[model samples]
Structures are given as C-alpha cells and as structure tokens.
Target: MTTFTVNGRTHQPEGPSEMPLLWYLRDLAGLTGTKYGCGLGICGSCTVLVDGQAARACLLHVGELEGRAITTIEGLSADGMHPVQLAWRALNVAQCGYCQTGQIMQAAALLAATPKPTDAEIDAAMSGNLCRCGTYPRIRAAIKLAAEGGEA
Candidate 1:
C-alpha cells in the first residue's frame, strides 16, 4: 500500500499503483477543488502542491507518492483566506471559474518560492496554466497583490 498525506490527513489508497493522483483526490478523497483538464498534462488544471512545490496531479501516480504530502485547494486555508486565495477573490480573477483553482494553486506555489516575482518570472511560472476565460491580466494583478500582502 502506498501511504501519503493529503491536507494533513494520512491515506493508504487501495488501487492500481498507476492510478493518477487526480482521480484519487477527486473520486476517492472527495477533493474536487483540483481540476482535470488536458489529461496529457499540457494544462495546469490539475495543479497541486507536492512536497510544497507545484506539480501536475494528472501526471502523478499513487505509487510514486509514498510518504509525500499533497495539498489541494481545499487545504489551502481553513477560512479561505490564504494570501493567494484572498488576492484571487479581491481581484475577481475568475470568469468561468473552471480554471481558477489550478491558477490559484500555481500562484500559491510561485509565491511560496518567490514572494515577489517580476512580470517575466510570473509569465514563466504561469505559462503552463491556461485560462480559457482570458483573465490573464487579472490573474497577474492578483499575483502581484498577493505578493504585496494586499487584499481587496
């Protein structure tokens, strides 16, 4: 059995070792905040924090997650007030809202690594995440706002 932690809770998932982390998270663990888009991993919709770094959940297998810590959007904050989340809310970053969770998770990872990122850095980091709603401007603004610790 592969043992891992999700949102501070431990789990030993029962399934094929090749089962994708996204399926386990959404179907079994009931954490639907992590989205599934472009199963080929081209899109960042399945983004989640693996060992505090952003990773594509759809590309990860349960067997490789033994002893790893995974954090989905639901675990981002108990009060929905993580700086990234607050920034997202304050700036109204979502339009369709389908890609927001992945965007937020990716931004959180970026902020965790680089508290203050330049436009180039932001572009480079966020390049993998696609927003069909074309909210790129607002997304960048919110990331900057979060870095500055500003909300609303």
Candidate 2:
C-alpha cells in the first residue's frame, strides 16, 4: 500500500505503483478537476500541487509520490474561492473552461512563490499551460488582480 496525502486526506491508493498520479487522483480519489490533455506533459491540464510546488500529475508516478502532499484543484478551496479561482471568476478568465483548473492552479502556485510577479515572470511561469481559447491576456490580468488581493 502506497500511502500519500491528497487534499489533506491520507490515502492508500489501489493499483500498480507505475500508474500515473493523474489516474490515482481522478479514478481512485474521484477528484476529476485535474485533467488529462496530451498525457505527454506538453500541456499543463494535469497540473497539481505536490508539496506546494506545481507538478505534472500525468507524468508523476504514484510509486514516487509516497509520503508526499498532493493538492488538486478541488483542494484549493472548499467554496471554490481560492484567490486564483476568485481572480479567475472576477476577471472572467475561462473560455471553453477545459484548461482553466490547471491554469488556476498554476497561477496559485506562482502567486504563492512570487506574490508580485512581473508580466514577464507571469509569462515565464505560465508558458507551459496551453489554452486553446487564447485567453492569455485575461489570464495575465487575473494573475495581476489576484496579486493585488482580489477575491471571489
């Protein structure tokens, strides 16, 4: 049994250790907010917080996650009001909405590390997350707004 903490709860996920953390999160834990996009780690749809750092869930194996703390989008806030989520809502950042969870999670991590990131820094931090709807401008604005203490 591989023991790990996700969303502040302990879990002994069933299955092979090689199974991607994404599957364990979605299938085993029933946290579907983390998405599966390219599955090659090219798109950031499967991003999550591992020990408060952004990581690609699809690429991380459950075997390697023992004793780690994992936080999916669902864990961000009980009321869907994490600062990034709030900023996302307040700024109307979602388009098709498929990639917004990962985008918001990544933004939350970025703001956690650098509360006052520059535009270039935002681009650098978020360059990996792809949004097919072309919502880059809105995303940048929301990050700035979140940094400025905006909330939902």
Candidate 1 structure quality by residue, lDDT tens digits, 1-152 = 99999999999999899999999999999999999999988889999999999999999999999999999999989899999999898988999999889999999999999999999999999999999989999999999999999887
Model 2, residue pairs in steric clash: none
Worst 10 residues of 2 by lDDT: 143-152
What are the models' TM-scores? 0.99, 0.97
Candidate 2, residues 1-152, lDDT tens digits: the string is: 88899999999877799999999889888999999999999799999999999999999999998899999999989999777888899888999999988998899999999999999999999999999999999999999999999654
What is the TM-score of candidate 2? 0.97
Q: Quote the lDDT for 145 in model 2.
A: 92
> Which regions of candidate 2 deviate over 4 angstroms?
none
